[model samples]
Target: MGESIVITSGKGGVGKTTSTANISVALANFGKKVVAVDGDIGLRNLDIILGLENRIVYNLVDVVKKRCRTKQALIRDKKNENLFLLPASQVDDKSAVTPEDMKELCSELKEEFDFVIIDCPAGIEQGFKNALAGADSAIVITTPEVSPVRDADRVIGLLQHHEIPASLILNRLSVQMVERGDMMSREDVEDILAIKILGLVVEDQEIVNAGNLGTPAVLNQNSPAGQAYLRIAQRILGENVEIPSFEEKKGFLARLLGR
Candidate 1:
């Protein structure tokens, strides 16, 4: 069976959705069938990030309501055929689908795909619970800021309470700021969260540009953030790829210039 993973953050604006879109594309590039589900009802945008916004006819709510079959709601990726998107309902609120419904939907998707990635909504409300319902594993995303880190710590505790395995993905990290003692380092965040590090995505403008253009950063070979996400996908597949040090000034510069 396929693994159902949730990409979540305790707070908004932490790049959780971006990570979900990029990781889904990365796994698809590795020859894995992947489906990304947007768990944020009433404010769905996973389709836009995947560049499949114009193709969404049936959404998650439609499937749950039996208005259409699961296959009818899936939007296949234009770049990678192995990737698909199950968009959330733009009209319905978070209460439209229960946690049990999410579990059943994820289980059904796992039967046909190699990976099911749920882009969870921010906060620990009903939407968060629904997103966590079917996830076998979770990737908690956070930035170096104090508020995000504190929120991530709370999320990790909640995951532990639910007996769900989780790892940390530190996003929007700035190496120069860390070196200058202006930001927290990877080790510092890990120490506070007490979770295994899945990956570290450095601050890169190319990621923003890629998202704006409806292309995932992971598909951009020249992007350092893309390389970091690819390595994370390899790790998810049980590969022992060495994660390069992003703390060094020269190493950061080299990666930024695509060297």
Candidate 2:
């Protein structure tokens, strides 16, 4: 059986969905059969990020309601046959499917793919719970901000409650801001929410451009953020890939805070 991994965030806009798309593509590049699930339901953007939005004829709700088979609902990736997208229904309400629905869906997908990545909706609502229901493991994404970190802590606790192992992905980090003391350093966020770091995605305009263009950042060989995502996928496959630091100096935060 394959693994079912859910990518979630405490709040939106922390690169959760984007990470899901890019990571799925990265795994596919490694010759793994990966399926990216748009667990966001009504507010689906995973399809847009995966650049398969226009091809979504069947969706999560359809499968839950037995309107289509799982294979029929899956849209093949434009670039890689190893990757597919199980899109969420844009017309259906977020509450239309229960946690049980997601559990069954993920269970089914994992049997056919090497990795089933569910891009969860932001926050600690029913949507979040629904996404968490079938996760064999999870990734809680956050920025370096205080609010996002706090929310990540809450999510980590919830994941712990569900007995699911969750690691952290500190996304949209700016090394320059950390050095200049204008932003929270990686240490600052880690101190608040103690968890294993899965990866660190530096802030890159290319990620935004890629999303707008319906291409995964990992597809851009020139992008540093894409390279980081490649390493993240390696780690996921049980490789001891070293995660790089975002700061020029390790103790930048300690010196700034006089700790």
List the candidates' TM-scores in order. Answer: 0.95, 0.94
lDDT of 2: 0.90
Point out where model 2 deviates above 4 Å.
246-259
Error of 2 at 148 (Å): 0.7
Candidate 1 backbone overlaps, count? 0
Worst 10 residues of 2 by lDDT: 245-254
**Number of the top-ranking candidate, with lDDT as the measure:** 1
Estimate every model's Cα lDDT from 0 to 1. 0.93, 0.90
| Candidate 1 per-residue lDDT over residues 1-259, each given as its tens digit | 9999999989999998999999999999999999999999999988888888999899999999999999999999998999999999999999999999999999999999999999999999999999999999999999999999999999999999999999989999998998777899998898888899999999999988987899999988899999899999999999998877764434656767867
What digit string (tens of lDDT, one per residue) describes model 2 on residues 23-97? 999999999999999888889999999899899899999999999999999999988999999999999877989
Candidate with maximal TM-score? 1
